[model samples]
Target: MPDENFYLDNDDIRFNLTHMVDLESIAELKEDVGSPDCAYESADEVVETYLDLLEDPIGVLAAQRIAPRAADVDKEGCHYDNGTVTLPEPARLNVQDLAEADLMGMTLPTRYGGLNFPATLYTAATEMISRGDASLMNLFGLQGIAETINLFASDELKDKYLPGFCTGEHSGAMVLTEPDAGSDLTAVQTRAAYEEDHDHFHLTGTKRFITNGCGEVLLVLARSEDPEKYGGGRGLSLFLVEKDETVTVRRIEEKLGIHGSPTCEIYFNNSEGYLIGQRGRGLTRYVNWLMNAARLGVAAQAVGISEAAFAEARAYAQQREQFGQPLDRFPAVQEMLVRMRIDIEASRALMYATAETVDMEMLLSEKLERLDRKDPRYADLRARRDRFAKAAEVLTPLAKYYTSEKSISVTTDAVQVHGGNGYMKEYAVERLYRDARITSIYEGTSQIQIDRAIPRVMAGAFEALLDEYADRDYGTVALNGLREALAEARRSLQAAVAYVNDQKLADDQRDTDYRNLTARMVCDMALDTYLSYVFLEQARHSERKAAVAAKFIQDMAPRVEMNRQYVMSGDRSVLQQFDLLTGAQS
Candidate 1:
């Protein structure tokens, strides 16, 4: 078994949750935060209860149960036997332990026999699981399925499926991608035909690259009506497809990494499925509901992988002797380790901030649903909930994009730190590197995440928030300098955005080029701002974190300015001379 000491302790999780981010204050505004009977049991208690669970021996169980199996699962992968897709032995054992521990439904509501954990807390657990073994995070991190059912499934559907899911009796798949409609879900060709006599939908389609596609239950996105009649997401409907004889797992793809989570090409031939939510709202509503949770899960998985990579590199650096000294004593090696540490921490800071904000809103919305229509305060709470929901919509994808991409960078560097040894199958960093590749690709690609974030960026939501961050009093004279440096980077991003808008593209290529340039500036500034705020919060506790934060701002501020300048001043060389760049063409 791997060293359990590397797993995230309860104190570290709490530190990230409570101090670096504003979990309790946000919770206080949320009515569904705590027990109704005791008003005195504030959000603080709610947070502590959550932390206490992290300290449980179950914490050790949750992290350890899956750790030992990661390697074998990766080696054996998933096997499709006849119609049934059999998971690798290690994968099977890992899922079984998760189910037995009731961790499969980590973020689902208690009403569905789940733990009713906050997204932040759930993400923290995900990080721990990922650290132990990145491959297992795919299986363990998909509590999104239960969350999806809780939000969209009717009482009948929820009653039938959620308990099984919560208890780990069932695993699930999001059956959205098809051969033609990988990224463009609006192009989904899977047909969900309504049966007038039976009043049930019969789904017939082939879905490719479906993650955990062989799971017991499937949330399928299918076209129910022609676009000429209903249209796009409006033509689409969500279905709860129980895996019976009608649905066949034709084959599980030989994946590049995270092989434990079965990625299957499924054939749904006249499969019976219950409609979830209203007709024509499946893609628009249910898919959105599912994807939001999934996006967050990806962020957690990324963090976990980072944790694993960091542990491997940090441990190796301390033990591995170089030039008659420990590698840590060497400047180049120390720099590599420092960068890896910062990368992980930066990703984590963004993940927790996003999760905390989103969970608070989820809690508020749950409370609002419980409030009577006649209650005087119901309207106010409902309005606040709506605002938080919108805020979460912007933040979730942003965090997912930032963290997953960071994991790719950090994990790759982790392997690099081990030099040639990292490339060998014997090293965990090699596995960690492969595992991290899937984080940005699935649950929507980094491109998709940015497409989601771009609207929020264009809307100037972060610009307004920047003002709020600027207004924060960094009381220490030394720290105030770093705050000013961050403010400058925020302005550079603003200038870059203005430049992009000023350059109206006539061609698709030019438009894409401009968007990519703009995206870099936006993401860079967002990360800088996020870290600046994280370190500012850290200053409230440790001087060490404050110093790290200060160094981060100083290093990042100039990079932000340079990126912004490239966006603003770099030639529209692509726009001005496309033919020149194309040369004789391929």
Candidate 2:
């Protein structure tokens, strides 16, 4: 029998698609996009068709084709043997399988041999692949890199690169990070100077800690102007650098995790590169656009890692006997298991909600573009596109921050459940434990995410978005309760903001301590409130989900309140009682 329970619920994704954001009308509007009379099937029909595919053999192929090789790939790792850094047999073949199945170009338009699937469906595929092996997700998820090129690449560039990417003939890498330029990509030292005769730029400098650095195609961010002309982010530009004699792989890093995907230290010596988009706007325009997409990919990777960790811990608890019966019988073990489930479910709910917003935005924009070029009669499509784009802007960072942080927590608990066994390489949790650590660290770290989110939260973008969801006439009683809970949570968050602003502490820039403390409180309350709404929405869609949703809401609501209280209490003990808490000489 097929393991249906291992995958996520389709109804939950659909609920997010329909209620979490307004997708039905957008789907209808974008339906007859390319083909006349090709009306979009119902949202439920779309969800069912996608689910049936997920339940099919293709789903198992990921676990069979990729998951089994995860350990060996991690052990053997990618190597810089000879001039070519070669991937292990399993890693190379897995990419080939995804390509052959037309999954590589999933969200791209069919004109480019892609499936033209919505971003929501692409996220579903991403979650499946991630569940099987978190390491492999890095390679498989490079479709976003290809997406950047497709969206911004010149016609010649797209024709040459995108086809290979879609067919798995080439792999893509985002070459941004360097030894000194970690978080501050504007400090990038890589130089790209244009040649008047050739009209192509020549790149020179070494880029370190690049994911898929050995990929066939590289999107590099380099300074095109005089090195000293740029202060922070100015005078930088995006470049399309291909694998060539001049671009050499100097070395590969043996990283803490994600061993299957090669991380390289690449040296560019007069490598011919084509300028992408415009000059002096690489950091601001191109890289910003690419990072937004990449952040969402990280969120999906987190969900995948969490699922893998949850499965191992859940199975271990059921099978591992302690004392007289299964370890699951123990109250402590049961509590751990429940917490694991709750966290994983909450993370996934947040991730899916984010994906829905992304999909709507992407599809709407595409629809409006097509209308502008080919069908000006459809003006409403343009308006819908703008609305979704705004929503996606606010939701993406929140989802990435929540999911990545949750992955760390879920994987940590997974190790705890395994006890001594988790420490050993014999169990998958050991590898998962390591892999889960990177999600929060990379793709604009959790701190960066909060920095991005603060403005949106303070500006009340999410508050307005939630108002739309609140207006819906939900059919389930449990869902209604969740809405009420979210409403209450929101009220608490608003109160925290008011209290902080009113207090003198909020204005003290010197004391970043208070701001950091308040940011966490506001984010947590908002996250819980958002999650409460998501779970309740799930319950509304299916009776089976009612208990799961209700259980989560009941447990999470109090934590939401507690987090709020922690912030609202105005406890400056960290400052006033700092010396008492940790003296210089104990």
Candidate 3:
């Protein structure tokens, strides 16, 4: 069994918690000073105590307890007998350990038996959990389900569900995807009907590929409009349904990776459900809110998997010899190790930056809601909230798109670093590589993320944010040089966006197609420029980080220009020749 505490041993995570993130400020906002729900003397105390908890009981549990059992959990997998899904013994034990630590409701209000930590801290803990066992993080990370109910569900529902979720007595699933309605949720065929006599709604639909679908509480999306007046997504409503005699687990998928987390096909035959929030806003409001947070959680999972893969590969490289010298001494192997670590750090920086913005948004939202209409602070706070919301919108998809893609590269390199051994199941990288494959596909694919992010990139959303980062003083000549390189890349990106916009606006019939074709290059340049700023900001904290920033800026500046050049080409051959290239029937 590994005895090293995952949180304490990781210098990068330690750096983030101590310096990169303002946990103290977030704690001050999240915790009530007058009468604290958690045991704390002050905001500093809250920060201190929380970090301690993560190191000892929580991080220790993850590294010492969960990491040891992950192999067995993956091997035994989940068993579906008769209609119920049961976790393997190791997986069950992992859940039990987390529940014992009162970790199931990391983001809920303390009033509801939760710690009420900000999303920043909650996501940090999630990274550690995923590092321990990526499969287990699926079950553990669904705490966001309870948070969604708290946000949109009725008070009656919150009273009944929040306590159970916080106490680990109950677990839940978002329950959105269907066999026919995977990416396009508007195609959801599930039906929900109100039974006024019983004062409830009945949900009848099938949900496929649901993570932890066997959970006790399910927040389902169903079409609720009148047949004659259906309005696409507007016709959909969110429902809080429970697992009962009416709900059945039809089958569990077996294959690729994360086997400990069951991918379920579930059937709801008139299952009793209560309407959550107002009617006709399920996909537009509730599910959108749930999915944005879920995408962030997936990014955390990707970075955790990257961390694990790097550790495995680095350990092997140090010990294994190539021809007469240790593998790490070789330029080829050393380059792989260096790039893998830099990628992990860059992803972590982006993920935490996005999470911090979300945390601020949540805090300001609560304040804006409670303040009187005439209060002077209301307008200023609301403006800040709106800006944060926009930043969060761009950063969330960018984080998801980049983190998942980088994780795939990092894990693939782990396999390559091990030569043939990494391909064998005997190695941890083999499983980590398999596990990392699904992050890009689920929640939302990378293509889907690009489609969502491009409009914001084109809208010049990064202009103000980049300006704020640019104003910061780096305190060193080398760091200033990196900042200037990033600035040059930003200028190139702005020009590319202008060119694409000008071209698309000029064409009426093919504008949308043209935009779609160039979307990836636009988003790539935007992300490359944005991520360079992130690393430059990190350069202030450590000399080693400054070196990392130098290497990354040097590497990405030319790539950003290259991507911009591609967009400037006005390439329409892909669309014009689609029929010829594919030999399609006209």
Q: Relative to the true structure, how large is the alpha-carbon lDDT of every model? A: 0.78, 0.78, 0.88
Q: Write the per-residue lDDT of candidate 2 for residues 213-258, one digit (tens) a residue.
A: 9889999999898866666689889999999999888889888888
Deviation of model 1 at 337, angstroms = 1.1
Model 1 residue runs over 4 Å out of place are 1-12, 25-44, 372-383, 505-513, 575-586
Give the residue spans of candidate 3 off by over 4 A: 34-41, 505-510, 583-586
| lDDT by residue (tens digit), candidate 3, 1-586 | 5677889888988887788888887777677544545466788998987788778777898889988887888889899998989999999999998988989888888779987878887788888888889998899899889999999888888999999998899999889899899888888889998998998889898999999999999999999888568667989999999899999999999969998998899999999989988889999998988999999999999999999999999999999997998999999999999999999998998899899889888888887786897998888989999998999998998898899999999999999999999999889999999999999989889999988888898889989788888777888888887787777898998898888777745535437677789898888888778878878888898989888888988889889988988889887888889888787845
Which portions of model 2 show Cα errors greater than 4 Å?
1-34, 37-53, 226-230, 372-383, 471-482, 501-513, 569-586
Span of ten consecutive residues with least summed lDDT in model 1: 1-10
Best by TM-score: 3
Return whichever of 1 and 2 wins on TM-score. Answer: 1
Which 10 residues in a row give candidate 3 its minimum summed lDDT? 503-512
Q: State the RMSD for candidate 2.
A: 3.4
